[model samples]
Target: MTLTKQHVRDVVDIYIRAWTKQDPDLILSIFTEDATYHERVLGEPIATHGGIRDYWQSKVVESQANIECELLSLYVDGETAIVEWEARFDDLVRGIRKRMREVALLEFDGALIRSLREYWASETIG
Candidate 1:
């Protein structure tokens, strides 16, 4: 199976939708069974679909954050994709709003994401 530009865009779309909807299933649906997710702030990567689901559940659904992700740029080369995204969301715990720009390096298995590493920095908003 080959990955296309549209497929990469669709994956990004699904990712944004998952965050906006705070749906664990939607988030999990986009990852391969053995997918690994790494975040710059985290000490270790989240391994496997189950771990990804649990992480999203806690950071998104459980936190009751409203997230909106915007795709800034995207480039694809075969099974690898590089994406820049901006996210604006409410931080329920901090009782404030925040904005972040992140770059993700994603590897695909067919149309699903096989591995993802993201780097991001957040800004506080009143």
Candidate 2:
């Protein structure tokens, strides 16, 4: 497996597309065999259970369902990328979603994501 500029873009696109559709498998496929997912909550990093099944059973899919994210910016350094996201919850039960910013730090092994650390604000309601 080789890393190229196009692979990174495709991975990010797959990420956004999966998030938009709330498709767990598509989301999971972007990850490597031993991928780790972390979310920064209340100034502490919450390590999620491995793989997409755990993610769907845990928080990512649930949190993702209520909102839609737009890519704000992306910066790449070798096999990593820091992506800025802006999301809005379109559903009424979720209330008026505040514009929240999150930075996804992706670590890639080849074209697969080996790890992800997503940092977001807890104060903002989704």
Candidate 3:
């Protein structure tokens, strides 16, 4: 299956919307039952369930204010989508606000995502 621009937009919107304290179940339903996601900037031996939940929970807890992520670019081919994005938050590592660029590769089985691998820059500046 291939993703169209609408599909990419929908996926991005779903993620951003989930960040706004929406129903966690709605967000969880967007992915496949066995979906796998990795945050290359941190963690190891993590998959879905605890891994993904911990990642997002930590982000919200770390930020002093609202954490925001925006879509910069998105490209899809075959069953995979590559998303280039930016996010702003009170850095949990540094305890200050900064922006960082993240690039992610997402694979979908039809409309439901199956796997996501995201990479972020190690060095972030204000």
Q: Choose the strongest candidate by TM-score.
A: 1
- Candidate 2: give the clashing pairs: none
Separately for all candidates shown, the number of backbone clashes (residues 3 or more apart, or on different chains) is 0, 0, 0
**Candidate 2 vs candidate 3, lDDT winner:** 3
For candidate 3, the 10 contiguous residues with the lowest summed lDDT are 57-66
Worst 10 residues of 1 by lDDT: 36-45
Per-residue lDDT of candidate 1, residues 1-126 (tens digit): 888888899999999999999999998999999999997536788999899999998989977587888999999998999999999999888888999999999999988999899999999976
- Error (Å) of candidate 1 at residue 68 is 1.5
Residue pairs in candidate 3 whose N, alpha carbon or C atoms collide under 3 angstroms: none
- Give the Cα error of residue 92 in candidate 1, in Å: 1.3
TM-score rank, highest first? 1, 3, 2
Error of 2 at 96 (Å): 5.7
Off by over 4 Å in 2: 1-5, 41-51, 63-66, 90-98, 122-126
Superposed model 1: Cα runs more than 4 Å off: none
Judging by lDDT, tell me the better candidate of 1 and 2: 1
Count of clashing pairs, candidate 1: 0
Clashing pairs in 1: none
lDDT of 1: 0.90
